[model samples]
Target: MSLGGKVWITWTRKTKSNYVGKIILAAALTALCILMLKQSPSFNSRSPFSNHEPGVTHVLVTGGAGYIGSHAALRLLKDSHRVTVVDNLSRGNMGAVKVLQELFPEPGRLQFIYADLGNAKAVNKIFAENAFDAVMHFAAVAYVGESTLDPLKYYHNITSNTLVVLEAMAAHGVKTLIYSSTCATYGEPEKMPITEETPQLPINPYGKAKKMAEDIILDFHKNSNMAIMILRLFHPHVSFFHYFSLSVKTQMARLGEAPRPELREHGRISGACFDAARGIIPGLKVRGVDYKTPDGTCIRDYIDVTDLVDAHVKALEKAMPGKVGIYNVGTGRDQSRSLLRHVRRLTGVNIKVDFLPRRPGDYAEVFSDPSKILLELNWTAQYTDLQKSLGIAWRWQKLHRNGYGTSVTIADS
Candidate 1:
């Protein structure tokens, strides 16, 4: 699943003969996109944090066993917040949850509940059982191509399930919500530097369902004082492992983005690359190669998992009542060819590449201007260098060749 924030598409330039017409058409499209964006009401409330004691806050993390959610849970636990993770384990790996438990080991520091978000009764039951201060909603099926193949699954899982969670939040008086959104919501916007106000013209069912969920939240926000922060993230690359458990007084690979084998086909490209290197798969398949980008391959803004978790923590801290903020999270943009080169170099494998035609629901170039998240959330991606980011993930891959199948060992920081 290509998890990301809001993205912008770089329009290809036409020949000199049609340059004037192209400019006029581009202006019209831009105006239309902005007009469409205005359909949703704006949120001007800021710094809405209420007066509270500086102590542990109970947080309910939906899909906490998944990639980004697991990382966010680790961060929250490290910050001394009581966390309750609810995941059905359909797409989430229990190993990630076990890792969190092993790292914390405290009774109340972490709890895992096997429940699906689609079951409203179970969702309400979970909320009734726990007293949650905030909710990190990260449970969703996020494969762009798969969403195209199974539109109903995307709607039911991403759209309807989000509604169920929001309803439960409203019923339980859980005010603060940190929503994990993707850049795919922007689709092929005819604009550069996508902002919160950019038109959300999603092209695929995954993006459409997510956009619908955002709309529902906005509608609810209009009537109530629910503090909401929707983070539209760009492509999150590489598995982030390596953390120091202060309680243990040592550093270890306690938590990381370890997707299960079944989901790898629909998971991050980095996982597939590592699998190919480890001889688990044949070779890397370059999906699209005729894109309009410099390398004729799609370009995306890849955010490191560590940096992605940091953005969520900052948003959770800044969430306040009656205020809503939407920000784009990304580091910078890199083409597919460049990423493959890095994987090959870092893994020291001559990864075979099979150039294929364009993939469905895929855009040519997708990146974002993360200035809003930087200014509002005070968050900026630290792992900006692709080589450095991939290098870190590759090291983790080397250690966990079977991905949580082997016993984790303690290592010096």
Candidate 2:
């Protein structure tokens, strides 16, 4: 078989395993993701659509139905703003949206469409329907490891599709945009903390694709007076207990931490699955700035889900002037050396953390210098103090320890 054919076959097999195997993996992933969500403690729904602001009479949110997109959409609705959601429903789930129907504050104010941005006709139709004040483009394939193996998929989705969307937006005279960016764009950093001025050198196709899109948008901004805000997201975890009952907080009091906990004995984590609303334990390796920094370990910026979303909402306000705004979206806080100790204290699982050599394309420490965003957007991370933020994560992990999930079956067409 051809190389493409072989990979296609293997991917097909993995996705279409026996019914029972698919069931087990789906249940496991969902439950694990739910717990991960709680542990990370994310943000959603801050801006109401009817804030009655002079900015953005109508907002076009591509990929508005995904995790961050859904949260942004909910916030827009809360501010009483006119909103439209366009998604292909590939990686995005419609069920994730809240407040689309009830308490909308305005009937027919929020709109949703199942369409791909690559289809310029569909996108152009969307632009024609509304005189949008700004566009928040969040629709793109975002998986680190997967991008390594299949860069074409990432490029097509993020690069080609993004070009199509931007052209349509510009042609329709919609100039404002709030883009979702990542810290990985910094590649392996030379400094402990990365500032907005840090050079971007992405190691993965996903980051490269995002960086490519960033360049294209800026190019458009360079020629045109289209205002742009790029929010470079640092990893933010969301940890929450279901229904607010049997809360993760309660579980923490009941259980204590473990010296080392193994997520699965002799098992490994696949790259595509390394997202916030999923598994948490990655073995601690010591190399990066454990000496220069206070801790003998790497520190990363981890903002709350809510705080991250707040940056996006604020970006809309700054979208009209045609000047490009670049800001690091993170807690301005760093995860600590004592984090592993704290995890064990909370999970009561004896996880074995073997110290390995420094992994390539890995940085020692990189948090955000969020001073500009704080000064510019009048925004700062609301959840300060890393320990306090982590407290909620422990609660989510411990609460969902047993398991709870819905069934899903994956297959290749």
Model 1, 1-413: lDDT tens per residue?
A: 23332221123333553788889999999999888777645423221122122576888899999888888898898899888899998888888897889888976678899999999999999888777889999999899988989999999999899999999999988889999999999998787767777899999999999999999999989999999999998998875744543332332445555666666777788878888888887988778888877778887778888888889999999998999999998875554557888888988999887888877998877788888888888899887777877877776666666676764454544
The regions of model 1 sitting more than 4 angstroms off are: 1-54, 245-252, 408-413
Put down candidate 2 lDDT per residue, 28-50, tens digits, no spaces.
99999888777773433223342
* Residue pair clashes in candidate 1: 4-183, 4-233, 4-234, 5-183, 5-232, 5-233, 5-234
- Among the numbered candidates, top lDDT falls to 1
The lDDT for every candidate, in the order shown, is: 0.82, 0.66
Evaluated against the true structure, the overall lDDT of model 1 is 0.82
Every model's Cα RMSD, please? 26.2, 20.1
Which ten-residue region of model 2 has the weakest summed lDDT?
A: 266-275
Model 1 vs. true fold: TM = 0.83
What is the lDDT for 295 in model 1? 74
Number of the top-ranking candidate, with TM-score as the measure: 1
